[model samples]
Structures are given as structure tokens and as C-alpha cells.
Target: MSTLQSQSKIEEANKELVRSFTRTVFVDHRPDRAVEFFDPKGKWHGGNFGTVEGAQNIAGLLTAVVGGLPDIRATEQDIIVKDDTVVVRLVVEGTHKGNLLGFPATNRRVRWDAIDMYKIKNGKIMDDWASEDGVKILADIGAYTPPWMKSGN
Candidate 1:
């Protein structure tokens, strides 16, 4: 295939991969497919410390955390694709219906803006870095109590 054609195909695959990740992660809450998009031993950086290796590890971690949110949605705001990577900027909206990160459900609406960069290898994702504005969501849900909020000396 010509260089231009190859680039186009890569771009399309990157976009689809990003979309699939969004669907599985935020919409369907299915984590079994994470390795299908990530390297089996890939290391994820930015805003998180967990190292996920293999699809089973990724699936188990996600499944454990996903049950907290009964309603969740992610909307892609923009996507930029290069020769071997795709960057997706999105906003996630959800309502807490169960405990998460030790915080009980407050039944409040929350939103977070995030950007994820996925590196593709052989038309499959190899690794990813994600940055998210999680503090905003915590503040929106009244779960983040600032020291300034405390009264009395």
C-alpha cells in the first residue's frame, strides 16, 4: 500500500480503537478487552500508578471499580491521530450509585474531563497515558471537603 493509504488506515484504526475503549470503559463497563488495545505488559502512566499487564489483569481491575457507578457516559470532544498514536479528549458524566474509592454514593451528578493518548502497534494499541481532572468531579459531588471549609478555631 502507498504511504498515504497506510497512514489513512492507521488513522481510521486509531479512531476506532479509541471509540471502542470509550464504549467498553465508560459505557459498557466491560474491561476484558483492555489488553486487546494495550500491550500485554504495557505500563500506563499519567494520573495513575497501576501497571496493568495482560487482559485479565486489566479486566479484573476495571471490573472491581466499575460497579460503583450505575449511570456513566463519556462523550468524545476531539480526536487527533498521528502515524502511530491517537489522542482522545473527552468528558465523562455520571451519578454515584455505590461506594467508590471509599466514598459512599452521594447521588450527585459529577463530570470529569480527560485526555488519553494511545500508542498503536501493528494496528493494535500498545500502551496509553491518561490525564483526568478528577478533583473537579469530587468537588462537584461534595465529596472533596477543603480545609478552608472548616469553621471555628
Candidate 2:
């Protein structure tokens, strides 16, 4: 095969790997399987939430999220693959059934959009940058009070 074809195949494989990982961890609610798709030293840069290093640490983060939103699921709206990177835009939906970020359970349904980019190496995720709509999630969960809702206003 030509070099271009081989590179395209590699990108396709990477995209598949990311799709499987997203399905297993978010849609399938299987955080325990996350480590299988991550490199031993994989790092996750979660915007606002800060960074989490190591495959186990990343898996732990997912576990905590799942704990808070037991019924959480992500629907992929867009996916882009280039070289060793894969970017996915998703809409995440869930119900707050347990404590999260020090906020008590609200039992409210929440939906937010997110974009995640992953770098693949040797068929495993080496790095991930995640951006989520935190403000919307907080508002949906009744955890945030908008300025207009303040009594002084």
C-alpha cells in the first residue's frame, strides 16, 4: 500500500478506538473498562476540573462521575479523525442520583454538551483534552444561582 493509504488506515483505526472507548465508558456506563484503552501514563486535561495523570487516575475520575450520575450517557454528535488524534463532540445526559463536586443529590435530569480530543499511541490513548459545559450542568442540577435569581437583584 502507498504511504497515504497506510496513514489513512491508521487514522481510521484510531477513530474506531476512540469510538469504542467513548461507548464503553460513557454510553455503556463501564468506567472500569477505561484503563484498558489508556496508556499506563496517559494524561487527561479536564478543563476547569484540572488535570489527571495516569490511566488509573483517569479511570477513577470517570468512576466518580458515574457514581454521581448513574444513568449518564453520551451521544456523539460529531467526530473528526486526523493523524493520531480524534475529536468528538457529544451531548451528555444524566440524572443526579448521588453527590457530585460536594453538591448533594438533586435527582434532577441534566444535559450538557462537551468536546473531547484524544491522542492515540500504539492503539491506546496517550492524552486527552476534555471541555464540558460546567455552568449548564450546575444550573441544571440547581447548584448554581444566576445573578438574576439573587435576592439583592
The most accurate candidate by TM-score is: 2
Candidate 1 has its poorest 10 consecutive residues by lDDT at 43-52
Clashing pairs in 2: none
Computed on alpha carbons, the lDDT of every model, listed in order, comes to: 0.74, 0.93
Q: Candidate 2 on 16-110: residue-level lDDT in tens?
A: 99999989998889998899999989999988989999999999999999889999999999999999999999999999998877788999999
Per-residue CA lDDT of model 1 for 1-153, tens digit only, reads 998998898789888987998898788877666666666666565464445665567666656556566677889999999888889999988887777656788888878898989887775667777786767766767788566655662
Model 2, stretches more than 4 Å misplaced?
148-153
> What is the Cα-based lDDT of residue 4 in candidate 1?
97
Cα-based TM-score, every candidate: 0.82, 0.94
Question: What's the residue-level lDDT of 52 in candidate 2?
Answer: 96
RMSD of each: 3.0, 1.8
| TM-score for predicted model 1 compared with the true structure | 0.82
